[model samples]
Target: MRGRLLALLIAIELPIGCVTVLTAATAYRTIMGDIEASQVQTTDDFAVRMRVWYRGALRSLLSFGATVSEAALPPELCGQAGLKMLDRARGFSAVLVRSADGRLCSAALDPGIDAQVLERTAASMRASPPVAPWKGVDLGAARYGQASIGDRRYLAVHAQNPAATGQDMQEALLLVAPAVLESVLDLGRGSKGMDIALVAPDGGIVANRGDTPPEAWLPRESRPPAELDRWHAADREGTERTYAARTIAEPGFYVIATFNDPHERDALIQLAVFLLAPLATLSLLCLVYLRAIDRHCVRWLRSIETAARSRSSSKRARAAMADDMPSDIRSVAEAFNAMVDEQEVRQRRLQTALDDNRFLVRELHHRVKNSLQVVQSYIGLSKRDYQDEARTALADAECRVHVLSAAYRFTLADGEMQPVRVDLFLEDVVSMIANLIRRRDQWISSRIETAATLSVDRIIPLGFLVADVASRVLRSTPGARITLSVVDLDEATIEVALEADREVAHQEPPRLFAGLLAQIEAVQSGPAEGRSLGRWRVRHHG
Candidate 1:
């Protein structure tokens, strides 16, 4: 029972655990996939917005470039044009116009630089935005560049301007501060924890939100990715991140977006908790249910089982426990106790009735023996008045009475419930008969080869018959040997044999003993006169 209950609890709890784990695992895949896709969309939107911002900024910068390069502009005219450019476009922090010979001819917004920044900016702009190389007095098509001037990052647009001096051309440089890129990123960042970067083909970060350069985010992605590619890679901190790349301004620039990986595991854990709490509560409730059954039912059953195992017939029975039990259990205990007590009471009454029966049976046997003895006494007294044969007849009658008396004594007083054992009755009856005729040198031997018993009524008559036959045999042939036996032939039958050896002429059995023969169902197969005699045997039910 204990094992079954434990198995039942396991049967309930195991499925709950398996389902929780499977559900969490499946949900982790599905939800994380959605989260990754959402993050990719974030980067995509930011790339689109950055592309739009660049187009407007480049157009306005180009218009200002046209203004300055309509003719050769002096320092004052360049300054006024640059100030107006700043007022028109908040994205522009400063501007520089330099001649094709690499001399700084003009500056705006209190710019604190030599001309070397513009020269290097022009030299690196060849691949991106497809700008041509500078020739003597003729700079190629316009292009944008991201450069560092004195540790500060700037985005610059450079274009050729028409100059009156044939070998002299003009180059325009526009500087954008880091603060402007940050504001653009703010517009694209959503609830998703996203990081974005504008990357150049030279493995340089054009603009990014974090301190780590964008190319280091995926060291293997230093080469340009195809348009709108997505992959998983590790960042500079040796942690994995999901990255998506979109070509924004192609000739080798792209927008790279990374899904924040540090938070992924934590997010999955939170989702698992959201699914696990209710199931955990259900598991706890199952435990509580098992506890309640033990408290209310199983404990009571255990007590009843203990009592039942210890019950004995010879000793008083133990009652089932009932104290402080639930009403249902108490009722069962009460019924069990009542049943045990009733059986005990019935057993005691039965024992008392048996005792009473023993007393009555013993008294009856005693009185019966006394009556037979009195009859023997009267026959012995009557022998005084009889002659030889008559006196011998009287003695035979006296011996038969003595046999009847012995029969009564051999039987049990209190054991009247069962039949008399045939062997015991034969032994005692044959002994008494031999003793009664001992002076005649006659003795009877008796035996029963198998076990059998008979009712008192059937057994007492056989004793009388055996005693009378032995007396007659001794009278007819002095010193006769008589033998008696009862043998079991089968479960339902027995054979009683009485035999006497005779050296004299054989005599017939007397008619006077016919009544005894009929009473015991004993048969006489011999003639009334002289007959050969070796044995007298009877077969009957055991």
Candidate 2:
């Protein structure tokens, strides 16, 4: 609450720094568009090489098949011709011809031919025959045949031709070695942060750029992004990363160009540029603005706060703030001064009220004394002209009047606004009643048992009730001692009972009944232990 001016300055300047930092970070990704463009161009070059490699294998095999069949070579002579073909095959691993029933007959290679791998590749090409390319290295009548077996990497190129017997067509598979695949990938790439992989259609990685495995760019559990764009996947180490994957050389085999995430490096670069940007200027501007606020605005507000908190009754702190200030802040100071002036005016009015109350008290005391004398005169006249019942009624009336007068005088004397003590009020009522006993033999005594206070609104009614009941007992049975039991019923209520012996005053109060005084909630007619004639329950009021 006290730092509102400082907070306002913070609210203004903080957003500028935040928006600048965020926009700069977003601009970093916009810069990544260039790196992504580099990767796309690299993959285009790699895909062209993949096409040459796939189609070149077929052209060489077709040449071998025609050379063997044109010489009327039998199944046994096919090995001699394939051996001659292998010498000029470049990176070819093995060239094998299989009989249509699928067992191998002739083979030529550096090591023994993998007849089973060739048979499997032939079967795979039969099941999922590939569509041929529309352009670039379309070898005539060459069907796609590639496979990844165990740790061996190769592309199987198959061609079918007659054995010169013309009974059935024989299948020949030419396997391109790993080195040949590497040369195809090594052809060209004009990009950074990119690695190339020749993945078989069955998702086996055959040849790649380095040992960092294609698994490092993309995890096994994740599918690549649908477009040539960024995706989130974890590496082999289970650390999260971001990369881009684009498929080249499609359909027959996937030339998936995988890129390592270079975002951390990019971010470092961006941070350096951001530090050199207008960010320092923004910070300096904020500092300057905050200092200006503290100098011009906050200084005046704090001085106004000091003036408001001053303890002097004379209100001399109004000049603490200088007159020269901003128009808005000056209005606040003026409001503070106006509130102080109002408070001072209220103080003088309260003092005047206190003086009036003192004069009122003096006049009240004189009137109460005269009223008691008039009550005494009425009692004298009732004794001479009336019977015993009427005289007793006048005496009860006189005691009730006295109780009210004493409560009023006690409440008004030197009082501001405070609750009247029940014990003190009852003591005064009881003392007045004791003085009322005229006969030498008749006497009144009391024991007040509780100490509580109530507002004057409740105290006056309570005093009237106590005096009314006590007067009944004293008048009905002369010389009967009175015990005023003032006990707490609960936290919110108090009970008063006049316990006496040999009194015919068990009837309910006629003048001041329970409902007549809203403060006294109820009346008890019967004595619990055969002593009290009447008991009144008074609820405490604020």
TM per prediction: 0.53, 0.48
Q: Which candidate number would show the highest TM-score if scored against the true structure?
A: 1
What RMSD, rounded to one decimal, does every model reach?
A: 9.6, 10.6
Reference-based lDDT, residue 501, model 2 = 58
Assess candidate 1 and give its TM-score to the true structure. Answer: 0.53
lDDT of each: 0.67, 0.64
Clashes of each: 0, 0
Candidate 1 has an lDDT of 0.67
Per-residue alpha-carbon lDDT of model 2 for 353-390, expressed as tens digits? 98898668667755775676677667756666766677
The candidate maximizing lDDT is 1
lDDT at position 57, candidate 2? 73
